[model samples]
Target: MTCQELYIPKSLANLKYLVELNLSYNELEGEIPADGVFSNITIQYLVGNKELCGARSLALICTCLCIIIFIYWRCTKPTSLIPGTPSMKEYCAISYYELVRATQNFSESNLLGTGGFSSVFKGELSNGTFVAVKVLNLNSEEALKTFDSECMVLGMMWHRNLVKVISACSNLDFKAIVLQFMPNGNLERWIHSSTTPYLNLVQRLKVVLDVVLGLEYLHHHHHQVVLHCDIKPSNVLLDEEMNAHLSDLGII
Candidate 1:
């Protein structure tokens, strides 16, 4: 029979001998009890209940529950602090599954750029926060070393002219760093693209000043002197207001 109820009745699970159920083409909108008939019924029997989840439905309630729990842990759990670094409470812990969802399985359309050892993709987190995901290519030893260097350096540093490290995901098979999203892209594009608006003398000077300040902080202000061996227009990212920030500290 057609069940137009908002939820599948939990009492239905108590029917021990009930062998068949056809709750198809209903307005049901909640979890389906897994006991009794639900366990035996095919997905066809529950067709058209778009909001229905759990048991034989296409979306399972258990999966949603797990995501909720995962998000809670990521937000509430205390991260290990680096020796000379500020509190890492601002960084949210992320998972490979979340990153996959954010970037649509790292689709080519989301690719921001690619480097010799890694590729960057634009992603939007569940909370609607935009971020850049830099996925490392683990086929070579140097790539692995670069990942380590970036994590070690960025984790301890914070500056307005430096790209902020949001978090990182690391496992045996996969490694990625999540960073602040730069909307205006890199200086190389703005300087080289004929179609892009030309940078005036003042704007050009501001970008140069930003890069110099960032370098000064890294080389002199930090507790330990750090040097960025590679500096180029491509590594200078522009944010929404055309503010410049230095990025790609992997080779430092």
Candidate 2:
């Protein structure tokens, strides 16, 4: 189930007989009440609510109170105080510090590839799930525009042959998009690697079909038109079973 503006009712805290509560993968907003049902909730039970915040153990950043004080101190305009965070409507908002630790300071060993405006690094979360982290270069204005574009497109589209967006992190100096790791690497590696066997005619057809289906979904399935301006072997990723998935949508 999907909801546009779902707020966990405060009356839920009054249910003393309720022993367990599980509300995940829904568009929930507002502060999570800390009275009863929320008093002992953990990350597993509360994850996927991208806009939730409270005194919960989950690292839901509660910066509203702090931002209010800062605005008062500066005597600035009072507009809607939206955090400079990744659009949490689709994916979890991760911290830059967590990403740094996950990639081990983005060591060379974990470096996947460098693109025009960003670099991809392989990272493993605390739960041991691997992810591809695209770190954007904040110094470039063009790069920031590209990052915002990618977030807008990827946040709305989902398909079997498209790379899964796990989470994202964005602050003043840091910005990164977290994605599910493709184990078999990109199509370029498989075709160029000397040790790897050549892809047979059947396997080659499958890869092409995957790409076509992914592009079809982007153009026909979405409400708005999306153009994937960049498409190449290096941008086409493969899974452990050699299934193809498109990646690198910054220019899409």
Alpha-carbon runs more than 4 Å astray in model 2: 1-87, 250-252
Report the C-alpha lDDT of model 1 over 154-193, residue by residue, as the tens digit.
Answer: 8778777889899999999999999999999999999999
Best by lDDT: 1
Measured by TM-score, the strongest candidate is 1
Total backbone collisions for each predicted model: 0, 0
Per-residue lDDT tens digits of candidate 2, residues 1-252? 445448888899999988779888776877788888778764557768788866663343433344456545433332222243234484666788888889999988999999888899999887788999999888878988877777777776667788877887888888898988998899998899997878864577679877877787677766677877789999999998998998885454
How many backbone collisions does model 2 have? Answer: 0
Clash pairs, candidate 1, are none
Model 2 scores worst on lDDT over the 10 consecutive residues at: 77-86
lDDT of 1: 0.81
